[model samples]
Target: MGEPVRSLPHLVGRRLSRVVVLIAVILSGLLLGAGIEAQEADNSTANLPTDAESAVAARVQERLGTAEFTPAIVVFDRGGDALTDEDRDVVQRKLSELQELAAPGQQVFPVLAEDGQAAFVGVPISAETPEEELAEPVAALRDAAAEGLPEGLRAQVTGGPAFIVDLSQVFDGADVRLLAVTASVVALLLLLTYRSPWLWLVPLSVVGVADQVAVQVVAAATQVFGFSTDGASVGITSVLVFGAGTNYALLLIARYREELRLVEDRYDAMRRAVDRAAPAILASSGTVVLALLCLGLADNPTSRNIGFGGALGIATAVGYALLVLPAAMTCFGRGLFWPFVPRVGDADPTRSGLWARVGHAVTARPVVVAVAGTLVILVCAGPALGVKVGLSETEQFRAEPEAVTGQLVLAEHFPAGSSQPTTVIVATEDRDRVESGVARVQGVQRVESAGEGEGSAVLSVVLDAEPASADAFAVIEEIRAVAAQQSPGALVGGPDAEALDASDAAARDQLLIIPLILVVVTLVLLVLLRSVVAAAILVLTVVATYGASLGASWVAFRTFFDFPALDLSVPLLGFLFLVALGVDYNIFLITRAKEEAEEHETKEAIATALAVTGGVITSAGVLLAAVFTVLGVLPLITLTQIGVIVGFGVLLDTLLVRSVLVPALVTLLGRRFWWPGRLSHDGRHDGRHDGRQGSPAGHVAD
Candidate 1:
């Protein structure tokens, strides 16, 4: 019997060697195919939901017999001095040169600042301009300004077009940086976790392939699904694949190492390890995938892309971790562990480690521990209710870029919204009435007939408030109300209007998608745990953690970061990640508890499970948190906010919720924690079970 058992691994390893080589070939082909088909990611707001602003923009374009145009503002400053005749002449010549470069039927206009220290040239470029095509026109305007500008005068290009060009440049090579940082973080963490230099390379290599494969898969899926890809989606996909894939690898490898000490053959140990780890990994991935898929119901285009793309990436990570990783590790045999290889009959270190002490303490006073944990999370959750959503365009950047600086200068000298006027498109017949109504709006500083179309006219209404400000949003809303009364089909569209619409869409998405995600996640947990009570506890705990994280982040954003308000998409995306990822730790803990309960009493099972899984789960959580924290390296405020919130939330879930709170709650609940399941009403109902079932017997401190 012993000889056959020992030989089983060799036989299986020999059979799998061919399969591993085939998988390697397939992965290489996938990588090559992906590289050949790679295309530039689109981050345009043209895919925003067909809200009022979008509909209005379309109508204006149709009426004018031209496509929508993005406004570019060139601000010329004379260093707080009144412009001289020479400066004015130079500016006028540059303005003319800029106008000459405009598309047919498009016009450029110049306005002097109230203080006479600055002036702006507004040039409208066709909105249909491809991203790569934008740099040329913008550069021409800049070059024209530089050609003959007076010594004291300085010109900067800003506004919608300039912002787009600059933002695209910021993200140009961001993928490489994000990948480098994420890979380094994961590799270092894995090295520390495994305590072996060589073991970390195997999982890291497999995960690298997984990350590449995920990108191609998600890109293809988005194209087929008719959803657009953005820089955020592409960037986050790498982070998710590496962070989550490595996590799954850690859990599997830890189990494989444990099985190695029990089983004589390396192949048999890995097979048993895969069997033990796959379920938890699958359950955790399922929760995240299902939750992210709920983003499809969102009204925001970016959210939708993230939802579908992130889900696909996670699914890909699971596949590689479970299938490719296991095969690769088995192919390497026992040598993969190197200096720390586990031998048969060796004791599990987890039997009495830091986790054992944690389990013992929590089991001693379950109620006290549970109550204290709940209170701590609740305290952190206090600020979330008052979180304000929506950041001004300038606030979107962690460090102010040239465009933002130009906007600030323009805002200080001119009507704040002059750089990007609120556009009201109305039928030519009602143009006069609609124009009068818009001009009469409370915040309208000035109104002009910027252009005319076949049967409609474009009314550019400059507001007293900054273009992306909340006051400007309110003013646009009022203008829309007035337009509806005077010109029934009039469309209100511009920078401020677009921002307003995005905020509304984000709010709607939060309301719609949040509930859907929670319901989906709850149902998934229920099915995976096979216990309604356990699933409910897990969901509630994660939700609590999410609230705590958001609330804490709100304080951090306002107090430390000095951000005026949260980005429109932050709350929705943050919730999606926190809930989905936070629940993962719970899944890791409870699944092990269920398995342990098959042999021991409920309380003893909880303690033993905690001692066994505490280290791996904590390491996984810390590793995921660290990878996400790398997002802060980017200069985008949205990414920074996401990194801080998700990183902090993961730590909270891992240390407080999973390590202490969950074990205490399960201990307090006893057999009832698994209500309606066979384990809940078995012979071990009274915490008196002692014998092992179906596996090797081991001691678990009570």
Candidate 2:
């Protein structure tokens, strides 16, 4: 009687404190959103590493006052026939109008191709200028080219400046689209999972706000760190927050709902839910955050920034879900659940669970389940053998942009690399020899001096193949070797050389980052599970899931979508996401199994874990997979490939690997699964279990 009397005030105080914390979290979020302005991430910083030869040449050119030049090529053609007299007049007229739109020193004129079928002018724009400043003049040129065109003769803008504008144009409004699609998908899934209008709103509202806050946080981080970022990386990060954050919410809410049935007081129920959910949430989020931070080691500026952005975004999501979400949920009390409010002594939701049946089937035949899963993974891996890498500049877009069309047209009428030639920089004394040597290289159409600086000169070398092509990349290498032999300090730098260097950098990043990611994930799993056997199995299954996703996505890309080659960034980015995120579902599953194992036999605990967790984990998995699919809307091949690969990988983890393989392994291994852990030694441990408690059998229904 004295104890009850004493605890009453403490209970009331605890509830009041929760309300205060809830209000603070909400107020803090609003302040964060309103206080910080979103600065667009800077992606124009060179994509290449500073130490790359192309980057070196760029520095020399900057010193020579020529680094700012980004030529916009204006192509005029009359289709199959040579340029007519009227077409030539229209070209000359347009060039005259374009001259007024150019920067102060830019010269605007057209030189006819040797075939007399087309003509182009390389109008200079400063690459160093802000995108907004560059866009104004470029828009004027495009607008001017569109009007006053002779009926048959059409003008199209292609080249470095035009393509850069095209890239920016497609990415316009991408974030809003991704947010809408992701929100819609999550909302629909929540409705289906909860079967209540009001309950869906809680997690959705919480996750929605978290996503916006994360974006702002990432934007702030980008400004603070000065890391390179693009629309694609930012969009991808937002998707991750919504997907992973909602997943965390689902896991917590499911546990909370399960607890609500066992307790009458909403606060006590929530306390139990948080106590159980927080460890698994922390472990999984920590693994993802740590793995993402490893991307800071990547050479590509975009990958590195994603590392920072993803980490910040996940941290924001986890903070809000674990802290703010619980408070908001309890504040609503049982009323928020509507018709399905969980009552004290209510029927266990999992009594008729579908996942329990799956467990039964698996436990009855673990060997068959294991063998079949392995065979499926192996079969899916076949298409990966034919996977290609490298997409040329024009091929970067999903739906061809105007610039790609114009570039293709330019290739038809002029030297393939005429519009965007490679620039070789060398000392003035070495320029002649470098040019002679470069011109003599196979596939080199032309090489000539462009400009001279204090001690350096620039040579524009046109290739027979389109820039960013295998043929053109080879030519770049040959030119570099020849130029270096002729002049020791000669350097090759241009769009083609930059692409070559970017590809090589991605390869090196893969070699170093992949191994580190594996080790990091392994260590996290080992520490969390306290079992080498469990950690190794989880890591191996995740690796298999990654390989299977790649193989499957590559086949689909080739057979259905007709993608020529996977982008160089695709493999590492896919691996980074697939392996790290692939383990997320497993962490949720095995952690629950371990908790159940403390009170039951190993096989029964796994089955019970599967039954209780199956619904929420599946919902989380599907939601995550769908949110990543939102990347397809961006129309960048790289982003789409990422979406497809990660999307498939997550489904594999959720549906096949985590759902089927990991469980069977655990059931078969039994006590050995927890080997060396204290649980393994005793086969039991102390936990809170009361006569009034609900059983794992309660979860089979959900």
C-alpha positional error of residue 635 in candidate 1 after TM-score superposition, expressed in Å: 1.4
Worst ten in a row by lDDT for model 2? 1-10
- Candidate 2 lDDT over 524-557, as tens digits, reads 9888888888889999999998889899999999
Per-prediction TM-score, please? 0.93, 0.93
TM-score, cand. 2: 0.93
> Residue by residue across 1-702, what tens digits does model 1's lDDT show?
011111112223767755874777587566648653434455546335765565558556655754466678889987678888888888788867898877668888888877888898888888788888898898887777767676878898888778878777777788888898999999999999988869999899989888888888876775576776777777777778888899899998998899899889787778777766777788889999999889888888888888888999999998888877877887776877978889899888999999998999999999999999999999999999998888877777888877888888898899888777778888888989988888888999999886786777788889999777778888989999999888887788877888888888888888999999889888888787677889898889998999999999889988999988888888888888989988888888887787777667778888998999999999999999998888887888888888889999999999999999989999898888888776677574333344424232211111
Worst 10 residues of 1 by lDDT: 1-10
Off by over 4 Å in 1: 1-12, 34-42, 51-53, 59-63, 66-69, 78-86, 96-100, 104-107, 147-152, 682-702
Runs in model 2 deviating more than 4 A are 1-26, 29-46, 681-702
Residue 620 lDDT in candidate 1: 95
What lDDT would each prediction earn against the true structure?
0.81, 0.82
Screening candidate 2 with a backbone cut-off below 3 angstroms (N, C-alpha, C), the clashing residue pairs are 349-701, 350-698, 350-699, 350-700, 350-701, 353-700
